[model samples]
Target: MLLPLRRALLLGLATVLGQIVWMRLATGQVAWVQVAILVGVTAALGTVFALNFTIGHLRAAREEVKRLGVNEERVRVARDMHDILGHSLSTMTVQLGLTRRILETSGDAALAAGRIAELEATARTALSDVRATVSGYRALSLDSELAGARMALSAGGVRVELPAATDAVRPELREVFGYVVREAVTNVLRHSDAELCTVRLGPAWVEVTDNGSAAGGAEAGNGLTGLAERLAAVSGTLEHGPVPGGGFRVAARGPTAALDPAPSKEGEPI
Candidate 1:
């Protein structure tokens, strides 16, 4: 390869130049001034070559790191898409199958109409979720998630309580927390038989705990895993486990700095 040849050339040049300088000095044919100038020039050229090589290597390394990071991000996005679409499609399939069964057995127009309406609603919800996922900027905030959780739980006849003094989460981190809250609430609605859910936010962390038996078939779906990855991307963490008292709990944490608000941009007059 060209690398070996280049290295060999440099070695050969160094050896020959060294011998020539040595011979010139031994024969007294070269003046001290000339020797000094020649040595200084050689040193300067070596330093330049070294710097050039170092810079080139560093640039190559930086580009490779960037490429790897981009690939990782793409993979993460693909996984998230798969999780969201796959679950939605599965639920839709079940609903459609139920509708078909109802249509085949009963010629009841009212029931058929109701099924159709449900299907339409499900489709719309799925479409909205897909849009949000694709946009990447459709991140929900913590306060919004809290409100949504309360509404959803109350609709399900589950009593809910939230903390009074929640920390002011950063915009990016708040989005991640919102996703976690949404996912937890969805899981509870779909799986748990609980009548009570509590959300607590403190200086250390935020947790959503439910007082229901763990569903037999419930597992950490791809959605939850994706949520974890998203949290980690913003230097946050997600933890989930069974609560000793009865139900399940999901929590996320970040540094105190992350909870601070951005400085105001107010200016004196104009």
Candidate 2:
């Protein structure tokens, strides 16, 4: 790469040469004023060349930065999709297996038919969720997640205790709380064979607790790691570990005060 000074000097030299040739042809000889004019034109060309070169580099640098930012967002979107679909697919797999077993073992047609219907319903719901994820505007609500958790746990043969409504929970915190519920319930479906699961929502916090050994395990997969990152972005906190006696628990807390009380108390991700 040519240094700015060297490039400038070359530009100035070229301009001086062209000016000299023109002056010599136009006038019989070089006048003092012509010499001064040549110097002025040379400086102007040099300065202009240097400035143009600098601007070009600056534009290239800006484009590179923009590309990097876009790439980063793509990575985040990919991670979110993996986490969402992983849990949903796992639940559907379990439901399908149950339906197949019922068909093979149950002598009663009605019982088998019921199980098949459930399986079909679960599959359709999963398909809709996948579509929402693809649209990139999925806004998981605390209410929806709680109801989903109850239905999913029941399907998995786990007893679930969930609140009817989380009206007390601040609106600003609902979405993140919903996310907490989703990942926690997903873990229960995919990894736990627990008999009981419970979800509780508070003013600024939500907790998912289960009486399953898988929750007590020390593994933190991409789902949990990503969950932690999401919480951090909202100035929230996540805690997941084994319950003191049995099973495991996951909890998240939002900001102490409204994120922006003047508006909605909810702020964009940091």
Candidate 3:
């Protein structure tokens, strides 16, 4: 393309400048000294031109790196926001709807008031989490996400069967798995009509299964896409699809970093 032409033009210009210097310094006839001077001048000019090109290229490369870094940060923020706000808003909607129904059927002011208070607390916590995520200070834990998933599923009227502990999962993968749990549960709440949701944990994998009829036909949305990317960053894999007969399953498996020699069943779904 144009690169070789540019290089040729630079070299040609440098040679022409060198020839002019040689002519000005010529003593009417060429000699060995003059030839040597011409060669030296041309080499010097070529070096100068080459250095200029190199510096220009280096500057461009630096700018490209900076731009790429900014883009990466932007992507990270967008994904985190989607995960945070999406789940929070969904939860709030479900809670409000459920509260309204309870009030309509039972006419229990005290119960409705208590549920409203809990919803308020959830909103506050979600706000705090959003702030933390924006400030790059948010840290997700498997245990906390498990608890949140259980609460969210139950609130959505899905009977949850969640692991009692996270001791079997690898420490480094806990955060990623936490994200998986959050997104998976959120999917169940928002997209399914499952009555039973079960979460199973192993040394290097976590699976969320629900008896939702829509499992086979569910499309891959932004949540699942981003979750897959996040897991891939740490050599982890995400598998999500309909089960053999009549359920949806989302599973995340990380590189084996188990604490136990064999997979333990200590954190089986309760």
Candidate 4:
């Protein structure tokens, strides 16, 4: 906020000082007209400086809002984790206590053994969930991604069209597609002012098209650049261009072998 104002002030002061020196050198005396011109120039520069300052302040405020939103999401995730694990651990502890009590009371070895097995399974399941969450390697399901895209577009009041059964995309291709979908949705939310968004998946290609203004000169942010790198990693290609009728389209393609099957409840094989 202050940076732009400071810069403008410095520029205006320099300009005014230069003009004063030039006038002193060129003329014997400083006239009232020169004084009025200097005052007017200073006022105009100050107004421009104020306008630039306001823009900077607004940008800072927007960034602060985004930061606050991210913080809120983190808090919500932590609370959910605490609730889930707390309950699971409490139940497991109770089961263990019961098993111990049975062993001491009746020496019922068979029942105690079964209870111990149950406890072990529960603990293992909880551990698996925690590991999955921490690893951040979520299984990418094409169907789920399509559904999510549909929901997002609908919520944005944009109509969506999807094609029929697409082939089982390769594991690597699926991951890349996941990133493409994410970036496309983000662009729609942030930049597009469209009445419709379309997602099409074919045997060897996936495309996202929106009926919004073209984003030709817009700068690609880190998210899109990172996604492009991911695609490049698998020898896949990503392309963005303007559509004939209007708006923009993003397409990504790669070998089908890149897609992986959904992980089983038993978890990934070691």
**Cα-based RMSD of the predictions, in order?**
9.0, 7.2, 5.0, 17.9
Q: Which candidate comes out best when scored by TM-score?
A: 3
lDDT: which is higher, 1 or 2? 2
What TM-score quantifies how close candidate 2 is to the native fold? 0.73
Report lDDT (Cα) of residue 36, candidate 3: 70
Candidate 4 off by > 4 Å: 1-134, 214-217, 255-270
Clashing pairs in 1: none
What's the ranking of the predictions by TM-score, best on top?
3, 2, 1, 4
Evaluate all candidate structures by whole-model CA lDDT and list the values in order. Answer: 0.66, 0.75, 0.81, 0.64
Cα-based lDDT at residue 174, candidate 2? 87
Q: After superposition, which runs of candidate 3 have C-alpha atoms over 4 Å from their true positions? A: 1-30, 257-270
Clashes of each: 0, 1, 0, 9
Higher-ranked by lDDT: 2 or 3: 3
Clashing pairs in 3: none
| Model 3: residue 203 alpha-carbon error in angstroms | 2.0
Model 1 per-residue lDDT tens digits across residues 1-270: 123446855875686578677878889565657656766776677667778878999999999999999998787667656645554454455456666777889867788677677667667866876787676745446786687567556645679987664464545566666677677776776678888887766543566778889653246777678777877777777777676667887777765534533111120111
Worst 10 residues of 2 by lDDT: 261-270
Clashes of 4: 9
User: Judged by lDDT against the true structure, how good is candidate 1?
Assistant: 0.66
TM-score of each: 0.61, 0.73, 0.84, 0.44
Q: What does candidate 3's lDDT look like per residue over 1-270, in tens digits?
A: 124646766876686666666766875544656567767775677678778888999999999999999999899989999988888888888889889999999999998897788789889989998899889999988898888887887788889998888997878889999999889888888888889999888888888888888753267889999999999999987778877667788877787734324222332243
For residues 151-270, write the lDDT of model 2, one tens digit per residue: 777778899989778988888888878878888888888888789988876677777788887653347888888888888888888777776667878877777734422211121122
Name the weakest run of 10 consecutive residues (lDDT summed) in model 3: 259-268
